[model samples]
Target: MVKSVSNITPFTLLDYPDKSACILWYAGCNMRCLYCYNPEIVFGKGKFTFSEMISFLETRRGLLDAVVFSGGECLIHKDIIEQIRLVKAMGFLVKVDTNGSKPDVLQSLIEQKLLDYVALDFKSTRESFLSITQTDLYDQFEQSVQLLFKTNIPFEIRTTYHSELLAKEEVKDMIDYLKFNEYTGTYYIQHFKNNVETIGKLPNSHTRLENHLPVNTAVKIVLR
Candidate 1:
């Protein structure tokens, strides 16, 4: 069977930031983050081939402004570049949501000018990266960050904050790392949704994230 996207959200307004978009959820991942909400996508197989996705896009070309390629780490898929090319040919902008485990794939997309925007997940500080993501790819994540830094393309670095998995100090360390790298964009801290089923067992956070955010950093911090 040809590995392909697992699902599609036909339309969404909030995901692409000011543009109407649809989300393509790819299957499988290189990391197993404890708090990942999309365990089914991470563990399951693709449901839609590229041709099917393209046909779906063809029907929505005039209605949607962009396509958000998300996943189980969308970059891990081998056909992503070609898939993006097909989507782009349809006159839709492309956005990718990634965990930054595949810098080489990212670089290829960037070089080909296939991506219009990116939402990169900054999973954890280097020391705790393995514990949170269950993968030793912090260096690859860092390399992806650097690739974004060198480009003119717009992107956002965000972290899913679950107090039990990440401490206030660790969040600060991540912010400091971004600052030291001279990242001058907004760093979004999205609170983990308590009711959703996660990849691992977790307790609801009792602490307020607003109180835990670092004070007056060079990077603009936004709680979402």
Candidate 2:
């Protein structure tokens, strides 16, 4: 379960696939990625009680088609299953955004059929994964990846184009990582926007994906 949620952005179109949804920002993260934009939740700057969150969701029952539980690592909280169950009982398709840290929790949710979609962040090549997440997370990430691959549920792998951690060549390594594992879901190469107030630095502008790889070529590899 989640320790608590700190914020709710109602009626988000971009979070859940093809459905109107509410976004729940869970508090606390195990990793300390310097590039994290939601530091308020990550650092526990503010918190919201579960009762208040449930009340809000209850108010919008028919208006929304889904609920997206984003984090600060949502799966870290032991109460995650309970929360997902509650949301599912309310008849909302649930989507989870995770960093692939808690495979056990993820697996349990999958077994209980709690999620409709999962968006997992694949941060960097294995060699630099620790540096990127600022944690010794290889084993946990490996387990999470395995669990996702084992499941037939629809999912996506996302990468933020961080010049400090990834490059043209490194993206190729990332491609190889996915191909080797036979990950057959959608892969999104998201443009990294620098929020200087929160994250404090911009990635090198010269290293945009379009500059390094042609559009068609990048998509072909990314969608692999």
Candidate 3:
């Protein structure tokens, strides 16, 4: 059974693709990224019932085009397939936002044709991956990238650009790494936004502001 999560936003135009969709924010992430903005969900502070989410979705049946399962990490729950099926049964597209550490589960979902789109977050280069994510899943991340590259599913690779953690050169290195692995997908560079969670961890000075792009850049890779 999937763990019941909290804070269900029934309608959003930004979370999903071109169409409007609902987001199901799952609670509790396995990795610990220091700059995590959603510390409530990551630290297990949010709570919501699945039945409540279902009721909300039922009210917006024809209004929403997709159901985005975002989280602490949706794949962490074993009942992800069932949740996807339920969303699909409602005649809504399913999009999963994951970190791509659980390749086996992700591959099973793709093979079963359960997800239409996936957004995988790549924290940093393989060398600093463990330091950033606080996990020894460098090999798992590589495996997941390869699986997504071979799959028919459309997916995107994204990384949050926080000056404290990664430099501009390292961002380019990440893009080069993905290109080397034959991953022809959209790569989005999201900038770190300051909030309560990142108040103390971020830099106080603006000395390195000119080191990289000020805003995030989502570059689409054309796989040859």
Task: Indicate whether candidate 2 or candidate 3 has the larger lDDT.
Answer: 2
Best by lDDT: 1
lDDT of 3 by residue, 96-149 (tens): 999888999888888888889999988898778877788888888778888888
Q: What is the lDDT of candidate 2?
A: 0.80
Runs of candidate 2 with Cα error greater than 4 angstroms are: 1-3, 199-205, 214-224
Candidate 2 steric clashes: 4
Best prediction by TM-score: 1
Q: Write the per-residue lDDT of candidate 1 for residues 1-224, one digit (tens) a residue.
A: 57578999999998898999999999999899999999999999998888888889889978999999999988888878898988998999999999998999999999999999999999999988998999999999999999999999999999999888898899989999899988977799989989889998989966667877667778998898
Clashing pairs in 3: 5-48, 6-47, 6-48
Give the residue spans of candidate 3 off by over 4 A.
Answer: 1-3, 204-224
lDDT of 1: 0.91
Provide the TM-score for each candidate, comma-separated.
Answer: 0.96, 0.89, 0.87
Clashing pairs in 2: 1-77, 1-78, 1-79, 1-80
Per-candidate clashes come to 0, 4, 3
lDDT of 3 at 41: 84
Candidate 3: Cα lDDT at 72: 85
